[model samples]
Target: MEHKNTPIYNAHSYHTKVPPQGIAPCILHYTDPGDLILDPFCGSGMTGVAALMCAHPPAEALHLVHDARLGPRYAILNDLSPAATHIT
Candidate 1:
């Protein structure tokens, strides 16, 4: 069965939710096997997952930045806070 093309913003399936389904063909078009793709923001880890699904090894570098006030203000508080630790 063929998967229907849906807007990336609206779909909830893993293929749609994680990676913009429309971009799969684009990825295949531009990238060869094992190429490294980078998504700096990496919100929800979608791009990495998308690269893996396309038979790429997944993006090699990921930098996650969380808001500071949401968690910790100093070294000690950061170490103790789960949100801060997640950032680390």
Candidate 2:
């Protein structure tokens, strides 16, 4: 992908159909190898995967706030939606 041509904006993967290709360039430009990056939503962990592929170790953390009964900040949020999680 052309780094300069692609638009940089906050958008969800489901709506834009643009897989997280933009992540690689962003990481390459601003961060060094082994630098930590966080993707709070991490729909499919694509940003983390890209970081790994680029030789940067990534620590992925997902925060799911949809279930009010479970309350926020619950780690179970990560486990509840396996289908929505992909780590490459």
Candidate 3:
């Protein structure tokens, strides 16, 4: 699938959510398919969005997927802020 400069992950409000464009390259460079990407302070889950774009650019939303060789790639989105977690 082709990757867009930014995915459709900013449909909600977030005070400090990292821009999808900003973090996507880092995710692509450091991670692989079926890997678990963790964001302890994931304000609004841009990291998961980035990771998902890295592994599967066409995905419409965050979800677990089965890979034939690597099993499943997961996005562990977490935050101490209830608002942030809920937003994520």
Per lDDT, the best of the predicted structures is 3
Q: What is the lDDT of residue 76 in candidate 1?
A: 19
Model 1 segments more than 4 A misplaced: 1-20, 56-88
Residue 84, model 1: lDDT of 30
Per-residue lDDT over 1-88 for candidate 1, one digit per residue giving the tens place of the 0 to 100 score = 2224534333433332344333444444555565666554444343443455454222321111121111111111123434333532
Among these predictions, the greatest TM-score belongs to 3
Runs of candidate 2 with Cα error greater than 4 angstroms are: 1-17, 56-82, 86-88
lDDT of 3 at 14: 75
TM-score of each: 0.39, 0.45, 0.65
Q: What is the descending TM-score order?
A: 3, 2, 1
Instruction: Give the worst 10-residue stretch by lDDT in candidate 3.
Output: 62-71
Pairs of residues clashing in candidate 1: none
CA RMSD per model (angstroms): 15.2, 13.7, 7.1
